[model samples]
Target: MYQPPHFKEERLDVQHALIQAHPLGLLVTNGSSGLIANPIPFALDASASPLGTLRAHLSRANQQWRDFDPAQEALVVFQGVESYITPSWYEAKRETGKVVPTWNYVIVQAYGRMRAIDDPEWLLRQISDVTRHQEAGRPEPWSTADAPADFLAAQLKGIVGVEIEVTRIEGKWKVSQNRSDTDRQRVAAGLRDDAHEEAHAMADLVETRGAKS
Candidate 1:
């Protein structure tokens, strides 16, 4: 998360939105055994802390959870739109041959002390929230209640829930903000032409950043 001032997104609202929009994050922790990271979906619990909290579950067998002591800190990285920026997309660079390639993207890093939530009732609620969030745009929505009694009980045994009450957040949004208007527009157009989702997303961000500027 080495963000230059030109690309740093210090807006609190933007940081929260990024984390909420992208629930899946890479949770990294440093404990007695050293560093460990896990990619998991987390729900934002605004009521839990002043800076808000994260809710996620890891498999009971996963050692990553055991390493997260209440006294230690962990980093949850929430990544938004990202894409490669080609030099050819910049009008100024194309004309003068002055610019090289770069990347445009948005990311938020949440640092906090991790806490394990072992209560069965709370874990169930957290699981339901996560499932609903992930299945938002699906055609056929699934639910924890859809499964049977014994089956659900057995399923719950394999998982453990945890929350990281976010103490610090750092946001980065590199969306061609440093580029000239003409070049930015060209970059947006070029991004739109790209076949990948991330490229199109970057194009949208470029447009939004331009509008805000």
Candidate 2:
């Protein structure tokens, strides 16, 4: 991930939390086609291993899964809020005119061995967990059981289950951590005023992570 020491996130708990917060991961595999990346929403089973396991599904028609070898490694990229940091926000920029624009973001890369599942029951369970997690706070939550059995069965048949046994995980929190406290605060303040939701999110992360350091 090309993370500098100041930007590296070494906390396991923090990395896991980021996955939970941003469950949509970019699953990447290298095969005869070179490389293919699929965006998939995953459910994490933290108890499965020290680094945790990932559960997702892809369309049965997707050839990326078929081409990938289970013995080889796959990478799941989880990205959180990101915002553009303007030099205009920095006090040092005005003092020395040396600062340039940068980006503030959080990213986690999970490396693991992936196994494909064809069992309908296991696929149903994976769908249920991920659905429940996402639908928790909705005004009217939906469940797999809400659908007709035959319809649900047919739906499951069209997709293939994916399970990843995580071997390692890396987190990078580039939330203005390299800047001084004053500059970090300034960046956060600027982000807070931005219209984008992720900008506001990055502002909070900048403040939170900086406080920890």
Candidate 3:
């Protein structure tokens, strides 16, 4: 996380909001198995600690859980709106022809001690919480109790729960903030004209966040 002074985001609530909005995090750990990374959906407990706590489950067969080193910290990266910016979209490109292409994105990185929990009760609760959070706004929300008890029990046996009490977190919002006002506004307009939803989201960020910066 090479953070420039202008792009650094230190607010705890902002970091947590990004994690909650993008729950699928890239879990990175360095252990006996060397460097391992997995994309896992996590549930955040903001009040669990001063920073926050992350709860997720991994397949029992996944070696990352077994490879956890208590002495080391694990990292989870949550990505939000992201888009590629073209120099053609910048006013500076026409004014001085000095602009180059760059990427714009919002991301959060969290670090904490990683541990695995093999208890069935904890796994059940972890899964249920994650499921409920994901299904909240759906018209037909499903629940863990919808499945047969035996089937649910059998399914639970195949996974292990993991907990991380966040010790450090960093957020980077690179949304054309470094550009001049005119250049940023032109970038946002270009992004909004793109067809992808993510680009549109990035356009909004560029306008709001760039203005603030």
C-alpha lDDT of all candidate models, in order: 0.86, 0.91, 0.92
lDDT of 1 by residue, 50-133 (tens): 788999999999988887667878899998988888998777665788889997878999999998767778888999998888
Find the candidate with the highest TM-score and give its number: 3
Pick the lDDT winner.
Answer: 3
Instruction: For candidate 3, write residues 70-155 as lDDT tens digits.
Output: 88999999999889899998887788998789999899999999999999999989889989988999999999989999999999
Give residue 78's lDDT in candidate 2 (0 to 100): 98
**TM-score pick, better of 2 and 3:** 3
What candidate 1 gets wrong by more than 4 Å, as runs, is: 137-139, 211-213
Better of 1 and 2 by TM-score: 2
**lDDT of candidate 1?**
0.86
The C-alpha stretches of model 3 lying farther than 4 A from their native spots are: 211-213
The residue pairs in collision within model 3 are: none
Sort all candidates by TM-score, best to worst: 3, 2, 1
